[model samples]
Target: MSRLTITLDDQLHRALKETAARQRRSIGSIIEESLRLRGIRTYDSAMEIVSKARAAAGLEPDEALELAVREVRQLRREKKT
Candidate 1:
């Protein structure tokens, strides 16, 4: 396990504390989880999730991420429409 030193402003600090309390986790744990989720924003990192979700679903590379993104939008659209 690794740790990072970070400075947060008033609102952000309170938000993190609230998130940690709501999730029944420590502040450091919440930060690590948030970082893990955002790690997929990069191509290389997202590609790993694409590969995993693809192989597990037996989908082609081109189809996997596109399918997930499509389904996400479809669900949101369904909620509105």
Candidate 2:
């Protein structure tokens, strides 16, 4: 487990608390969810890079998309067990 202490302006703090109340969760949980939402940007960037790299490395768009989808589906199947 880890501890984090952060400072926020009055409005932002109020907003976070309100969101937590609406969701029936803690303020800490709201902050955690915010982080998770931001982390999705990393995945989006990585996929963009992969597509660009594939093109520069001579893989076609359709080929790259197909490979990405296939790998993702294969991973999901493997994780089921």
Candidate 3:
């Protein structure tokens, strides 16, 4: 395990502490979850995820690529709203 030190503004720090207490989780866990939600992933990790999804769906490379493109476009449209 590694340790990280981040400087947060007083308000943000307080909010994070309170959220952690309320959720019964460590501050590190909350921050890690936030990072994951924001798509901070390595290329190898992302590829593994894609590989698993492709296998599960039984999709060929081209079909997986097309589906991925469509899903990305749809997410973009939804995010714009």
Candidate 4:
């Protein structure tokens, strides 16, 4: 595990703490989940996901890459809306 030091506004800090307490989860976990939900993945993790999707769909490498790119772009657009 790695340690991180982040500066948050007083209100946001309080809210995060409260939410963590309510959910019975550590604040770090909540923050990690938020980051993952927002598509902020490490390179290895992203590759793992792509590999799994390709295997499941029986796609060729290039075809899988193209499909993954298109789906990611569509997801980003949907998130923006």
The candidate maximizing TM-score is: 4
lDDT of model 2, residue 75: 60
Model 2 global lDDT (CA atoms, 0 to 1):
0.73
Choose 1 or 3, whichever is better by lDDT: 3
User: By descending lDDT, how would the candidates be arranged?
Assistant: 4, 3, 1, 2
TM-score each candidate: 0.45, 0.47, 0.60, 0.69
Stronger candidate by lDDT (3 vs 4): 4
Model 3, span 7-81: residue lDDT tens: 999999999999999999999999998776555677887567567668889998777767765665676566556
Name the candidate, 1 or 2, with the larger lDDT value.
Answer: 1
**lDDT of model 2 at position 22:** 91
Clashing pairs in 2: none
Best by lDDT: 4
lDDT of 1 by residue, 9-46 (tens): 99999998898899899998777666554432567765
- TM-score quality measure for candidate 1: 0.45
Q: What's the CA error at residue 63 for candidate 3, in Å?
A: 12
* Cα lDDT over the full model 3: 0.79
Which window of 10 residues has the lowest lDDT sum in candidate 4? Answer: 72-81
Off by over 4 Å in 4: 49-66, 79-81
**Candidate 3 deviation (Cα RMSD):** 3.9
